[model samples]
Target: MSTGKEELEVEEDFPVVDQDEVVEPPAEVAKTNLAKRRTIDALLAEKRLQKELEDYPYDL
Candidate 1:
């Protein structure tokens, strides 16, 4: 008697990462990324404030 099951094969196109091999960015690059993020956040906050001001009723 044979088991009615077929083994499936899968091929991965990306490299496998090991938890031990994780690394952090260089200090300079990290600082640059942080600055960029802060700028983006400030712009978003300004946009939200502008929208709220537009929605506020000045006649009340």
Candidate 2:
């Protein structure tokens, strides 16, 4: 009887999770992430241009 009670308690302690309930990023979140990536890319490109100008000041 004690073992059965312990089993029931253990089962009740853990809630069941449904596989179908997945967490998805919102559209706004995706857009924000894209914008952030673009900003980072732009910054990197600007830095590269500065480095290139420093290396070849006479070319420009």
Candidate 3:
């Protein structure tokens, strides 16, 4: 009995995995970060408009 060939089959019922369990983040923390990103985007858009108004040569 010296055979070393082993075959194993693995099957999962629930294929979906929760990413948070592997690298968890608090709910409030994630929400706050999303809010901050939105605020930053708004500020960037405002600055872009200001630059366009100043740089564009228009006869008024």
Candidate 4:
């Protein structure tokens, strides 16, 4: 009974510690993400231009 209590106490004293790890993206994955980002940017720019054209005043 005393040994069991001691084991529990030891476990309580030392909690689990998490180790953070920095993972780097692979080259092919990085390239794919960059391509997707560029496509999204182009689409957004086109939408912005269309909005501006609609809002432009043609009363010159």
Q: How many backbone clashes does every candidate have?
A: 0, 0, 0, 0
Q: Tell me model 3's lDDT, rounded to 2 decimals.
A: 0.86
TM-score, per-candidate, Cα-based: 0.53, 0.51, 0.48, 0.53
lDDT of 2 by residue, 1-60 (tens): 355545343445787778788776766678898999999999999999999988885854
List runs of model 1 lying over 4 Å from the truth: 1-28
lDDT of 2 at 51: 94
Each prediction's whole-model lDDT (CA): 0.90, 0.82, 0.86, 0.82
| Model 4: per-residue Cα lDDT over 1-60, one tens digit each | 355545443445776555655555766678898999999999999999999999999999
Local accuracy of candidate 3 as per-residue lDDT tens digits, 1-60: 647686667876877778775865656788899999999999999999999999998986
- The TM-score obtained by model 4 is 0.53
Candidate closer to the true structure by lDDT (higher is better), 1 or 4: 1
| Residues 1-60, model 1: lDDT tens digits | 657697768977998899889997766678898999999999999999999999999997
The candidate that wins on lDDT is 1
lDDT of 1 at 14: 92
Cα distance off (Å), candidate 1, residue 14: 26
